[model samples]
Target: MGEMSDTGRLVLLGAPLGNSADASARFREVLATADVVAAEDTRRLTRLARDLDVTVPGRIISYFEGNEERRTPELVDVLAAGYLVALVTDGGMPSVSDPGYRLVRAALDAGVPVTAAPGPSAVTTALALSGLPSDRFCFEGFLPRTPAARRSRLRALAAEARTLVLFEAPHRIGAALADLAAAFGPDRPAALCRELTKTYEEVVRRPLGELARWAAEEEPRGEITLVVGGAPEVAAERPDDDTLRAAVAAREAAGLTRRDAITEVAAEFGLRRREVYTVVHA
Candidate 1:
């Protein structure tokens, strides 16, 4: 579409999660111009190009979990040769619970310039639709496959205060939700988003216990993104006015600005800045 420079670059293309219309113009340009295309599923890439009415005439290489290790070096070599290399996964962006991490790292290590052809991602899509806490959240890709390991991982994450996002296969949906409820508590709020951006798209919002029961009975089908409410913070004992004043003073004496000291003290004790400000002034 534009003049091709001799400069080599690696572009990570974000594929539409499910709906083809989500393909952006920038993404199409990168796909068409890339000299070498490394795709998680070559067939799916071809189908996507067809859907978007964009022709990908570049050399297509299959790069998935099975051959990522073997194909990584080859991709790096091509990137080193001033080739415009583009990587695409079946759905969503590459490298997030998908192939392309090793290749990206390898390309960067080889001093090859790398960038992204941004598009919609299921993580944000589901999180937004779930109506869960969006400000502070962590995407935990997918839970461990094995039962024992998955349980252990959940145990470790039980006390995480940040909202949790994760992917789950249809078959394991029931088990995963049950384990989550056990680890995070039955009453913890959560939302299960499935078949996102598709005809049968559905978002089920409920507590962990209710979701677990629903999954067990209905057995959801399609790619699932789960958003779980963060663990409630433990209530902190409110320090007396003297203690708050002394704490703020100590922080200020340790080289913090008065306002910064007050902010830190308020956050530490879970008090509002205004509350601390009034207390200090009084």
Candidate 2:
């Protein structure tokens, strides 16, 4: 930890999701002042800097999937030399289905302090805009590219109870939706958000089947994000008195007030709050 100040730090930059205005003040500052900037697409980085009207005074280098393995150690060497290196992807955060994981891992392995100026993510954006329950959801990122592999993946996820979020290229949206419908059932509720936070941003909410047809008809363009509702949960049998008391006690031990614990336990157990209170107080 003490090496933080002594060693060069790795900054993970979250590029604007779609709007140049989404760039944070610190995001621009890092771009302008870092000793080196590692970008997935240096061309996109240049375009983004032009959009933001921010002149990057630092040296920029390509650090993408193709060369990530070879580039990681080189960046770590820069960090060892006490030069701040900021990493930026084409969009969103450096890594959440994007490159940067390898570099981050390598940096940490070398005891370099790493941090992020977090930015917008399509996973949560589509989930929030989808109107699906976000309290407990899963991000599946991009599914398999092939029909057989994609369907197999969806089949494995069919019984997942948490809301599922995924990304698909515009060209593959129709086929992906079709595979999703076939795997998860046609009636499953889903949403397709495209060109997020941009001039033509659009979100379409429909069942998996309808989304498939919509994609076929519209041939939606631009980046695509999909959020799907999870499978319905089967109700569990009610637990006994000791079990209820332990559940309440666990929440209270975890820093919840007794009242909040009761409320949460009741919601989970499908009981009135009064029932949990009675069990707790009893």
Candidate 3:
């Protein structure tokens, strides 16, 4: 167990996503020594520490979604008292779509030193196993639960050029994949990584449409991390200047305003509205 400095520190420890062996030595050391251990799930944290042969002698407090708002200020106060305070979620880093953001923010505001013992992350793990373009990618967390909102969100990301990483519940995986296929187009390539770094782990890489079909037939289980390929580098078919102009002219002749004509033409050709406007005005 390491000793806390005169000035307290707020340490955010990254709990292992699945395998217990992934827990770092620093994680064990902090668990053994921190004055206050705030965990998303106390049971899960205890089990993890036990599996690592580490004992958490400090006070343990539940700091999950239900109590985070109420608990954050108290934890921050502990940090201000020159005691080392450690925060850990059920899995992964504290605040990546998890419950540690508020506590971290409060600690920083209260002038409590904030640090992290970074370890396993489902996001980066899935991305590495995804075999997708990881150079430029974004973590979308989880999609909206409602069908309308989920589809709307996917539609908004239809033109995203960077790879996308998302988390989804096992039961909702099928519907989400179906919605993704509808919004991003069936042919878009994607990888579905489920139960990563644990027993019964599965990674399925296929086109969105095919994956959706598979999910429909076979129910997926356990935690899910989806890595989807971005929109194509070049559209399969792009209308030439003459074709775009002709389409715009036809729409205008059919009683559509110039703006409406350009909008319609651009959507039809998968071209940007600004690009269509340029062509139409030219």
C-alpha lDDT score of every prediction, in listed order: 0.91, 0.90, 0.91
Q: Can you write out model 3's per-residue Cα lDDT over 1-282, one digit (the tens) per residue? A: 245567889899988889999999999999998989999899988888889999788999999999899988888777877899899998899999999999888988888889999999999999999898999998999999999999999999999999999999988999999999999999999999998889888999999999999999988899999999998776468878999999999999999999999999888877899998998778
- Model 2, span 158-200: residue lDDT tens: 9999999999988888999998899889999999999999999
Residue-level lDDT of model 1, residues 1-282, one tens digit each, is: 233566679899988988999998999998888888899889989999998999887889899999999999988888777788899998888898999889889988989998998887999999899888899999999999999999999999999999999999999989999999999999999999998888899999999999999999999998899999999999778999999999999999999998999999999998999999999999
TM-score of candidate 3 against the unseen true structure: 0.83
Clash-forming residue pairs, model 2 = none
Worst 10 residues of 1 by lDDT: 1-10
Index of the highest-TM-score prediction: 1
Candidate 1 regions off by >4 Å? Answer: 1-5, 238-282
Please give each candidate's TM-score.
0.83, 0.82, 0.83
Residue 154, candidate 2: Cα error in Å is 0.7
Q: By TM-score, how accurate is candidate 2?
A: 0.82
Query: Which candidate model has the greater TM-score, 1 or 3?
Result: 1
Q: Judge candidate 2 against the unseen true structure and give its global Cα lDDT, from 0 to 1.
A: 0.90
